[model samples]
Target: MKTLWDYTIVLQPDNNGTFVAYVPAIDGCHAWGETPEAAQSELENVFEMIRDEYIEAGQALPDNVELVASHAR
Candidate 1:
């Protein structure tokens, strides 16, 4: 049984042509990639690690986090 965490990720293109992604609700959670899909994928991976850490520490996730529509991309 895996816990589902909803995190909002923002993706932006850097001047160097790579995309940068970050979760505003999770500090220090960010990643970069050559495309929007890659950036999103990396961000999701980061979210997983963050979620695991919170679960391990018995801490609550942010209340505002919600799973946005998958097709929103």
Candidate 2:
């Protein structure tokens, strides 16, 4: 069984006029996009990569960091 971590995604305006999305619970898990949806879409990839790295290192990622959405994204 896999333990999934729930994190709150924060979106902000970048200096370059792009949108930046990130998960506060995960360090360096951020990406920039031209729109909010794109930024969030990119964030999923970053989070997945980070999660894989943690598993490969035999480390457990943080769990239930924040509230998760009730619906699918």
Candidate 3:
């Protein structure tokens, strides 16, 4: 059985009140939804698609990473 990899995702609330999510390790991989939960669900789908593409192309997967949440005043 193949081991499942987990990637850290960053979720941020935009000015419009919607939530946006992205994987810090994957460039151009992101998704947005009205709620944080929805955003996270959409992001999960995006991650799977990107992973599949990488597998098909024989490309190395993005490195697993984590980002600390910080607020800017």
Candidate 3 global Cα RMSD: 2.7
Distance from true position, residue 66, model 1, in Å? 11
Worst-scoring 10-residue span by lDDT in model 1: 1-10
Q: Once superposed on the true structure, which residue ranges of model 1 sit more than 4 Å away at CA?
A: 1-5, 65-73
User: For model 2, where is the 10-residue window of minimal lDDT?
Assistant: 1-10
Q: Which portions of model 3 show Cα errors greater than 4 Å?
A: 1-5, 68-73
In model 2, state the lDDT of residue 41: 89
Q: Give TM per candidate.
A: 0.74, 0.77, 0.80
- Report how far residue 41 has shifted in candidate 2, in Å: 0.4
- Clashes by residue pair, model 1: none
Residue lDDT tens for model 3, 1-73? 1112377778899789999998788897799999999988888788888878888998888677766768999
lDDT of 2 by residue, 1-73 (tens): 2322367778989999899998777788899899998998898888888889998999987653564558777
lDDT of 1 at 1: 23
lDDT of 1 by residue, 1-73 (tens): 2332355667899899999998777787888999998988887787789888888999877754554557654
The positional error of residue 28 in candidate 1, measured at the CA in angstroms, is 1.2
Better of 1 and 3 by TM-score: 3
